[model samples]
Target: MDKIKISNLEVFCNHGVFKEENVLGQKFLVSAILYLDTREAGLTDNLEKSIHYGEICKYIENFMKKHTFKLIETAAEKISMNLLLNWDNLEQIDLEIKKPWAPIGIPIENVAVEISRKWHTAYIACGSNIGDKKKHLDDSIYALNQRETCRITKVSDFILTQPYGDVVQDDFLNGCLELKTILNPKELLTCLHEIENAEHRERIVKWGPRTLDLDIIFYDDLILADDDLIIPHIEMHKRDFVLKPLAQIIPYKRNPVNHKMVIEMLYDLQK
Candidate 1:
């Protein structure tokens, strides 16, 4: 909730659409606000507990000088993402990239791009129905933990469950993991897919047999429906395997659409 602000820091970099802009270079001004919890630092009077503004400025300068982009939009996005990845305490960032002396014929003050990015909390249901199920789940957790943008905060005990769909294969070892992530929904989905593929998970049939199954059961309070992904997992409320393990860790987590807690859903499903 607290912020550390850096205002109008100037840098010289090559980032522009025109040919001459890249050849000759130009001046860029950046403004940033990093959101974080500084309470511990304030209470303990420890500099390590807080983000170092000087270090951040140096990082931004280096990043801008090192990379050449055609647009300020790209520069802003890359810088924001880099800052978020480098700083663990940073919860959100408001970044602005200003380009002065534009090639436009008009005498404008400056052209700038401003944007905000933040981390989201998401819950994933993980399962494996074939070939070292426990190993599959453990490896998935280890993979998530290794990511800089994501942290595995908690995991539920695995439960043995019958196959939910018509596929007659093996019972699944299902569980859930709660993650704190800086990755966007789509990025997180991509990471999950990559992890699955690394485990050699074969999707021969829907809900058939898998080496690892990672589903985004909840993403903040978001309600999303897309061709490749669905948020709050469409059938999570009805599946005891999901609700049971979810209840073990996040009993109070609510279904975005139903507005019912996981504990309530699990209880109701029993009858």
Candidate 2:
């Protein structure tokens, strides 16, 4: 993680709640700390090896001027997302949008909204036991990639596996995918649930059969447990259907909780 800083680049933009402010644009100061690996650029002494700060400055100015939003918060968020998506080498961004000409009666210097945004890698397990299993899995992958915020980076070969729970059901088509997304853990979970619902998934029993099942097995080496969802998926290590496919794509990925790689977990389950 290396840093490239841009300070107090001023721009005139029409972003405010008041109508007058929108009609007559105001001055705003933009700043950013871009996170990326600059080693190659430094060693090679080539501008192509790293993001060009001059080009980035131009992009930020153009973005700020072209969009009209009511809040600096919105401006900051949109800018961060655009910068990250547009720059392949950019890993993270710390952005700040300062509004100096506020309508507030107080003598405050300025108001600003600052935020940090980045891409996150997540592992998702997909299972389908009913109605055109392979088709269901393929469709789910397509749906996930349809979103601009999410991309399916890698996929494991779908394997036929026996049902996990006591409920007698047909063999399931199970697999795993590596997802690169800007969504947070909860947001990503919501996206998964939406995809499941679209595939007519029902949760009538504890381990009931379903048209589609999408679970978040891992989120960026994160350990999380909430009332609704858990990261590293509570029982992922014990299930071969999950570990087997996961191992195919990211065998060396370690569980943040147990510190076991995917291959080791699968070996343990088989043992």
Number of the top-ranking candidate, with TM-score as the measure: 2
Question: Candidate 1, residues 167-194: lDDT per residue as tens digits?
Answer: 7899999999899997889999999999
Candidate 2 residue-wise lDDT, 16-49, digit = tens:
9999988999999999999999999999999888
Residue pairs with colliding backbones in model 2 are: none
Clashing pairs in 1: none
* Candidate 2: C-alpha lDDT: 0.93
